[model samples]
Target: MKVDRVLLIAGGRSGEHEVSLSSAAGVLEALPYDADVAVIAKDGSWLLGPDALDAIDAGEAASGGHPFPPPVAWGDYDVAFPLLHGRWGEDGTIQGFFEMLGLPYVGAGVTASAVCMDKDLSKRVLQQAGLPVVPWEVVRKGEPAFVGLEPPFFVKPANAGSSVGIARVERYAELQKALEEAFRYDEKVVVEQAVSEARELEVALLGNVRAEASVVGEIRYDAEFYDYETKYTAGAAELVIPAALDPGTQETVQEMAVRAYRLLGVRGMARVDFFMSGEGELYLNELNTIPGFTPFSMYPRLWQASGLTYPELLSRLVELALE
Candidate 1:
């Protein structure tokens, strides 16, 4: 694909705002082509060009840019790279906007983005596809109880990412408080059964219709669970690539990752996470449509381990968008 100008959109009102900024920085440093930068401030305003780069450098949280203008006014570019994570960014909202502007962008389309952003809906879809998923129950605010899931459950906002609104509840009594915290992020929440002594595994995916999976990776952490701090803090978690799994298990993980990626309608890229029990049982945890791109992020690192360099990966993604 012949490309001239690229529009890289980042930052948003989601809880992952800071994380998005970090990912944008990593992309900016390694992007092989000339690109225009656009930052969506916490107030839902837009920042363009050098101002956007300046905000990212200064770590500014508020938008100093003007309110979002018409798509034509955003400037002319060959394609857009919406690097924003969480809510409005990762959900179908921005994708739909790009669609209205008749612009090609990176990552999943509308239906896929919307479904994958909601944990409950995605789990249901995966289950319907005959995929093994961790048992979970959806709960709404003011609900009396969430049945079908036991204690030591993971309560999380169905629509947020980067562990932004997540909590570990060891007992039923603490469910309400955890629900309250999750509700702050979204109206609906998911209470998932925690897998015991399970190893956290991940697979990076690329391509559109015929997506390919990278070597399986493992996340070894010492925290109670992989929380927001543990995910972002330097040296907090160790990412093991080509996770020491037997050939059979590794093949199974790779196959499942590809299946899930196509099933969820994901394009360009994604990170498929899984939980493996000591008994060798594997359960699909969740899929990240816009996985982190920080220095410590597992997405690009998984591809790097698979022999794809960072700049190469960025160029390939742009080609995919143009494709």
Candidate 2:
């Protein structure tokens, strides 16, 4: 299918609003087509027009004086590219909205978005499929308890991404504070046992029906952990494509990534994260349906390493959506 008019949606009411705008910028610069960008304000208003991209480029709202339309009116474009991350965007809300509008958008569908956004549910599904995941316990508001898990675990919001609200609790006494921090982002929190000598690795998956995994990439950071700041802040982390792993290990990571992608029913694109322990054990961490599109992000960089340039990568994703 030949895609002409493209509606690029970005920004949202989530904590990753600024980051989403940055992702939209990269998508805008790399798109092969003249895409009409739309910005979803923090209040959930859709700001769009020919000048929407210009307003987003200046980090300003396009709704100040422009006429904003509802999501149902997005049928003007042949395809839509939603770069909105976090709650309202990546969590299946916007995907369902697009589906209701009879609009085909890039990336996973409603089911995939919802299942992957919720860490607890995704973990259960992945584990049931015989995939190895980091051992963890779920904590609710007043029902917090660690049955068999030990301390020195990482506490994170079950529905957030990019390490928005994550904490490393080394002692039992720190559990409450960590849970509080995590609860700020989500109702359910996951406390995972820290992987010893763990190495952060990621793989980018693309396509529908039969998805393909890109070469694995490793993340190296000097921060205590890969927190939100370390992920977005310049120089806080370095991504090594082809991940310095042995050929066998690299192939294993890629294979498992593809398996998880297909099992999760992810259609267009996804970034699968893994944790490799010092003993060579690999654990499926989580999946990001609409990963960051910035130049430095691991998703595009992995595809670029696999011989797909950023612009070509964006084009392929749009084509996949149309397919």
Candidate 3:
């Protein structure tokens, strides 16, 4: 497909709005084609052109543009690249909009995006597919936060990303507080058993039907866990590409990543995360459709270690969307 003008959409109604703008800024700097920028403000307003770009560059809230559908002509762009993260953006909302418009957009389609955005649902699907996933219990709104799992649980919003609205609880008394925090972001919550001293491994996948996995990457962090703050804060965590794993382990991680991607119907691009316990048990953590494209993000860096440059990675994603 011969790519030309692109519509890059960013920001969202989710807590990851700022992070999306940051990622969009990186994409704008490296995107190889003529791209129009659109910023969806926190209040759900759509800002286009210079106003959108300026807000993304300034890392502030956008002021102008209409709501829902932007005032711009969508036919001018060849493809849509949604850089928005979390709920309304990454959770298949915008993807469906693009689908209705008969436009090819980057990342997974509606069903895949919706399923993967819900951690509890995605884990259930993974478990049913015979994949190794950490034990978790789902608690819906107005329900008792009763989990059979032991203490030291990671309570999180089922539909949120970037570790937002997540709490690590060490005792039963703290479970309510964590549940409350998680419920603030989503109706459903997932209480997952925390893997002790686990090494965070991530694999980046690209393509549609026959997806490819990049070199495994490990996240080394000094924080209590890889939370939202640690993720966006510069120098808070180190992403070690070609993670220090044995050849067999690396191969296993890559294979599992691609398998999960295919099983979940993910296409274009995704970052499959895993947790390796101190006892060496591997667990599929979660998969991120439209993974972060920021300078510090692991998805791009993983592909870089696997011999794909950043600009090349972006171009390939657009190509995959058209394919």
Report the C-alpha lDDT of model 2 over 242-299, residue by residue, as the tens digit. Answer: 8899899989998898899999999999999999999999999999999999977899
Model 2 lDDT on a 0 to 1 scale:
0.86
Per-residue CA lDDT of candidate 1, range 96-181, in tens? 98898888898999999999999999999999999999999988877676467778889999999999889999988898889889
Where is the poorest 10-residue window by lDDT in model 1? 67-76
Total residue pair clashes for candidate 3: 0
By lDDT, the candidates rank as 3, 1, 2
The candidate, 2 or 3, that scores higher on TM-score is 3
Residue 113, model 2: Cα distance from true site in angstroms: 0.6
C-alpha RMSD of candidate 1: 1.3
Looking at candidate 2, what is the lDDT of residue 83?
Answer: 89
Selected candidate, larger TM-score, 1 vs 2: 1
Residues 60-134, candidate 3, lDDT per residue (tens digit)? 674556977778788888899999889998999999999999999999999999999999889999999999999
**Using TM-score as the measure, what is the rank order of every candidate, best first?**
3, 1, 2
Highest-TM-score candidate: 3
Task: Tell me which residue pairs clash in candidate 2.
Answer: none
lDDT of 1 at 259: 94
